[model samples]
Target: MNPVPDLVPARMVSEFVYCKRSFYLEWVLGQFQENHEVAEGTALHRKVNAVKGSVPATSEEKPFKATSVQLSSPELGLVAKLDVLEGDGSFSIPIEFKRGAPQLGDDPVWLKDKVQVLIQALLLREAGHKCSTAYVWYDKVKRRVSVPITKEAIDWALAQVADLKKVAASHKIPKPLIDSPKCRRCSLVEMCIPDETNALDGKSAQPPRRMVATDPASRALYITTQGTYIGLSNGVVELREDRVTQEKVRLLDVSEINLYGRIEVSSTLIGACLERNIPILWFSSGGWFKGYASGAMSGNVDLRRRQVLASITGALDYAKTMIAGKIANCRTLLRRNAKIDVEPTLTELTRALARVKRCKDKQSLLGVEGIAAKAYFSAFDAMLKAEMGFTLEGRNKRPPTDPVNAMLSFLYAALAKEMTVSLLSVGFDPYQGLLHEPRFNRAALALDMMEEFRPLVVDSTVVKLVNTGVATPDKFQYRGDGCIMKPGMKKDLLRAYERRLDETIIHPVFKYRTEYRRALRLQCRLLAGVMMEDIAKYVAFTTR
Candidate 1:
């Protein structure tokens, strides 16, 4: 059980009154994602956050005003950082700054804002100053609304604090609001997933609105050249080798960094990436995923606890769902792309998918998956144009024997790495999985998530590369019977893989279009929703 915080911030109390689930996500789970509104609010607070003056300790002091005053009250179990505090040697007023205009009603100030200021007033009174009223400064309209701090208002604020404490101690996330207008512009809307959660939980019958962006503003930065040095300078990432700069990219434009083989990165850049919550993935030159370095682990302990328990008790159920989705997707891909006759293979895969539901345990599930995979891979070569000179003699890995197999192996590893990053971002333990058994140094959960995406992402990319003549016979070199992609070919493959990720497709369930990259995170979040019991079941993404 989690312990309740000793002192609740006045801001959080306001947040609780506005939306309980949002407060729980931000305060309890430590989940926060900044959007344009939040960024603008931060910018607006810049001058006010710079502490300028102090609140008078005694009533005998002369009149003074303070900006950015920190005060806490143990007796009231409250803390606040006032944007502005004014005292005239006898009475004090706490002023809170807001980015937007005041509420449109008889009371210009919102109840949440009023409660926050009242709490701040109580904190000031606890500091031995006479406080009776507070003010809310709305910067958007340059307006100030006065809120009288009455005994009744004090009681209401305290009551809210008490209720918040109970909710915190309970460790049960509050249900998201249904179809609220407040969700449209909320910075945490994507994380909270209010509409999607409510729809999945059967609380709402409407389809969820498209809250997330079609394409991310920032993208992954891949470093593949041998002996490349990555350093930070003036908010830019500079790739230097042999003391000469090869490339430069602004830090703000990079969402994550992927380093392959013998690359060196400066500690400063790594620290900056950590501060920004950007993951750095490590891979071998042959596209083998090694590991990753990240900052603090996710704070969603309850979800992970549930995941561990489910992995122990209910692994087979999840395995069936994911494997069934995988087989269905594989059949769809073969049906849509295969040039040759693949009716028999498609029928066999459909039968395998049906067998998935009747599997008794993990072993049976694996057997079903293997059968489906064999049937799917049997017709995989027919998906590509025969004139491209690429043929796959069934899927082979760990030193793929043929060029097509090598490319497929590399792209699959990249997809697995992408899933790992997505799972980590959604606060899942990547090593624990349902379909794939956890092994030492293996991201089994990522592998499990990769099942449904392999045919849609990696295999599709391989097909496009082969049919478009981007990958040719000369692009591969054989080393002791192991086919490996040459340097130029590896770069080409990465480009094609990223392009596939950027492609937008309509989600089968949501009836909305989103990029494959964003869909990865969305699927992980949906899985989390199921684990958290906000949703009835996990719905695997299967492209039509």
Candidate 2:
């Protein structure tokens, strides 16, 4: 006997008919991003979504109009919360509110809309109400189109429901649409990356179209004060110190909350952040990442499962690609910024990159990476101005001996935290790594991904801070044998780091310009695509 299918929302059936890939991403993977159109549609449905009135069971009851009328059909394995249900005792009409205008031709309703309303009608019928017709209200044109609920339409809708269940159960993401007009208006276009996937797979000859904006509108909120308390007040986040309000920000404006040192957060505020899908990152006073609190793990179980398998099977090619990108970027940074002749160091890095490609196992890859890192950092002090009174003996951490290493270590910690968040957002097991060995409480996958970005983001930021005199030797203090940044210096470094993340660069592979922050998430999504076998191979981000 076949397994019983899980009940799906009627809206999902409509989505499946519209775009199978989209349905899979949303229904199966639990991914969603709101665009302007979606936002507008949400605004239009505010009243319709509110539950009011009720659907009567008997013809003897008086006529009534219900908003947000929920109905279900067990035998059909379907459920729907209809926008509006207009009913007399004997008959009922289901109405759906759409944000866009109706179709241009004789069949004025879109197939997806028709199927959606028809399914709602089917649910009403299952609930013992006679629903012969449905109405679609196009808020854009302020017109209502009537749809006849017929046997053929009901059969087609049921078939789509069955197909959608099969697709969901298959755990395979459908191939994206090729240059379809539907992509232009889709909110998930950025997540789907249709053209990019096709281009990487060699199915498309053209470069991927930049269909969606890459930069995030929301920004991370950093709370660094030692005794700050965070609380929620009427949709605003309030930061208080000593029972006095220090700052208030609208919750919608914050994407992530980064807390450093001794900070208190109210349970209400935490709940609000979780509801909005904003992660709260905890850090020690010295800028070491502790952990993060998020609402729930990403629902992309298939991707995470594949990640675990790949980790055990030894993803040698992925390891080589990441390390090669790291070595290449390190060489580029040295060549671009080194004030002294470092031709030998450059040659050694090139050799290391060559060795990375030839390595047969993770042990050899680690050896090559160590050699490349030593060669790169051997001449690291040459990149800084001598007048800045800063020098690097080599990369030192876990109590960096010098101001340069201290700053580098701090910035590296920040970069690792960023990678951790990126990996979590893409539904990967941040603790499972292809190159880095897993340790208790260590995000090895984040460490693996941050290798390529260390020189490009953190190291570059450190050099800029030193050479520009934004960070001075006076900003650091010696505690025991370890050097640490003063509180003021820590603030300045964070500001510079955020600015660097906001800086835009052209992607060497996609040939599109995007901010580093978005690029991080984009790279994570691409990595997930590789794990899911949607893309031909993993391509690490490399700068020119």
Candidate 3:
């Protein structure tokens, strides 16, 4: 059965014909940028599309030429605005204007341009106009190329649109083309990163996809209010403010939904989420972990048993590696952000890294990790400007008595929730521990996994917020021997956290740039692979 797209813009069909990944990147990922070629193309499009009124007949002009003919067909769910529609009402033809020269092959014209005009022709046919043939006018060579609107070409274009609909259904970005020349001219080169990722394509045994979600490109919806209710309506997740609908998101576009405070969710929404396997995380009004709920687990039982066994008996090596990564990342953060001379702190962290390699058990690993953390936090106060008044005396959790501690603790707790979900998605039992002690309700494994990212994601974000005066002392309320964020501060911090997660960095192992959220998921998957002995050694994320 062919999947029909909800709406197919005729231009996107041309993009689909040109490069599938470009279409996915542009439409699905909502990513685009303007390069030289794109700017030039835009200028050309403006010039061609700006021809107002009828074309005056010259020696070189066609008998009947009209500029910018708009047409749509509800039956085919297609829409197009041809650059020029020629001939008469009885026998009209759509002519597309191309910025470049006509690309002629065994076929009459370029398939991308051909399919585009064919769509315009189809739309014209549905709108009660005769459209048997179409023409493409090339500006560069001043040539007119004819494209036959044959059944074979129309069927092929329809099939392509159906495939595009299937891609939309998945909500995952399609892989880049192998050895594509179009990549060189693509405006999204930096975003797509085809140069580095494409290197893996030639290999017979390629690495696994480096994201944890069922669909990596899907967006997460966060609800912070207490009285907000979520329900399912017409294949979309509806957010209501006390029974009045506020926002709606299609079910397929949501990867995860996080509910904070006393947000109410109906059973129908839960069932919809379960059917789609999107995890829902619950947090306190103050951004503390409350609980987690999700659909059925998808990891292998045997692999999980092996992971549990490793955590219980043989996790010291993994702990040492992860701790080393954490300490090294902490040093890097200090080196990058510290205003004063960071040499002393970096030297101490270097010694801690050396001590990590020699650690034979979890206790020694903790000792080294502790020393590195102490040095890192002692220098943390110097990283910020004095005007910001955000200072870290030490790493404190429970009450987070200071402003810096309050923000850091909240960020860490949020990070733990993300790591917990990521670990669970990759089939790891969050309660099992490698470094942190296992408790009945504690997500010890998630804590262990988040150690490396604490400095990378949380500390870096805190530094940026504090340095930029984005998080002020007034935002933190001191009461009852503890400091907590106000409502405004909480919103600002959530925004900061989400932005940080979207930031991309080159992966230490994969050597390809990926979002921090995807990196977190990738790390969990890599750990799972290590436990399953699919990979010889576990490599934790580290930064320069």
Candidate 4:
């Protein structure tokens, strides 16, 4: 039996025309960012295309009009949904509605927009319609720009369709354009890191991070409650508590399984998870990172090699930027949420930001970070609502003396796991460090990457959990020297952490809204870009 040929979406051709790297990121990696421009365009199309009752929109000059027509060409392996067709059955022209203003003659910026309609016309022609010309209506200008459907345009689009099919089969990402003006308006810029990847010197920079599909349907299973037993059953993983099945999910649906202390997992299940490339992370009862059981190394070896080399060569710049991000985020968080005046802390953070840029060595960078952390955390006590009974005397990690410190430590550990997973997904050696000291059997690179997120993720999460009464003193048990969280409390914190990761925020560089989880991956990819010298500067995720 002959295998079915792969079909290429007509819109992807437009993407390839816009930027080959963007096309790869979208079509291959399944990554996307939503921004105001994208939203505006979507809304505009929806409004224009939602014309009811098939009452064809006809202009005084043209007597025919049809909206939202689906056309496909099986021989070409292409499918398209034409926005508007404005001719008779045999002879028709495609009218594409764009949200942008009309551009003058031979503007390269509108080339992709023109190619989009040309592809639609090609598909229409293959469907037994004669399309000689296509029109693009600009919403801002209220003018329809006519593009002739020439032999050359048809041949170019057909070749691109073939190229797109090849790309689909090969699964190789295209190189990004360096400092392209078109990148400023591209929605995928944050994820693509065009500037960073394009800036890499082929000799010094490492290979760019490989693009991996992040399944939105996959879920993370948190075994928070104690006495829970995990086992394999009929290609599905079952969770039981007190001999009662609490949940059962097919192994395919699970991406990662995290278990707190006292949770038991059968060896069979562990092996099954590892075989399926699902990582299993273990946390202490008090939410401390113990270790993780994951599948064998699956990423590119050269990427790891480059990560080690780049960490040493770019240590100073990486260290400085990460610390600056941490301090800036700390100041922003204090100014926005702190009940008391944060003028002093903000001033100190400002000076620290300035000093961080001038740091020539890792030692100076660490010193600046230490000073910023001191100033930032000193004001932490004032930010908490007095009713919560959570106070932070200082940032204490080992055997946290206060409930706040315990939560912070636990949250930081959780963030570490997230960063490590993200780095691994992008084929980085999580043990190599630029900002943090590398230790035996430690993911120091994850620690280094998490520096920027400490204030943005952990600190903010703890503050919300306490101030909003989501987590109270009763949720934490006071031990001889430290505080511990019960399984139930861990469950609550897990819920909050997952929610925080799922929360969407606007990325400052791309001006696009992305989930915190995907943002972590973006940061990792950007770091890879920097290591490869694809970009000039590494921009961190800083909150307003």
Winner by TM-score: 1
Every candidate's lDDT: 0.88, 0.88, 0.77, 0.77
Instruction: Sort the predicted structures by TM-score, highest score first.
Output: 1, 2, 4, 3
Considering only N, C-alpha and C atoms within 3 Å, which residue pairs clash in candidate 4?
A: 196-534, 196-535, 197-534, 199-533, 199-534, 200-533, 200-534
The number of residue pairs in model 4 that clash at the backbone is 7
Per-residue accuracy of model 1 over 107-130 as CA lDDT, tens digit each: 899888998999998888888888
Would you estimate the TM-scores of all the predictions? 0.98, 0.96, 0.62, 0.65
Candidate 2 segments whose C-alpha is farther than 4 A from its true place: 1-5, 58-62, 88-90, 213-215
**Deviation from native of the Cα of residue 513 in model 2, angstroms:** 1.5
lDDT of 4 by residue, 1-544 (tens): 1122466677788888878878866665555656667878899889557543232332223346667777677677878777877776446788888889876657422777877888898877676667788888888888888888999988888887777667655534567775566776777766676654553433223323323234477778888777899999988999998989999999878878888779999999999988777889998777777778887664344456667787767667777777888888899889989988889889999999999998988888889889989988899987899877888988987788888888888889899989888887666788888878788867888998888788777888889998999888887787788777765667777788888888888766555566888778888988876664445577777877
Clashes per candidate (backbone, < 3 Å): 0, 0, 0, 7
Task: Report how far residue 419 has shifted in candidate 1, in Å.
Answer: 1.3
Instruction: Report the candidate with higher lDDT, 2 versus 3.
Output: 2
Q: All predictions: root-mean-square deviation over Cα?
A: 1.4, 2.0, 12.0, 11.5
RMSD of 4: 11.5
lDDT of 3: 0.77
| lDDT, candidate 3, 1-544, per-residue tens | 2234566889888998888877865665444556766766778777557655563322134457667666677778787888887766346778887778766566657878988988987876676666788898877888888888888978888888777788765634566665566776677654454433444344323442332212345777888877999999889899999789999889879978888798999999899888767888888776787768887765245446877888879688889888988998998888888888889989999999999999888887888888888888989987898887777887877788898888888888789899988877666788888899988768999999999999999998889999999999888898898898887887787789989999978777666568898788767856765664434477778989
Which ten contiguous residues of candidate 3 have the minimum total lDDT? 206-215
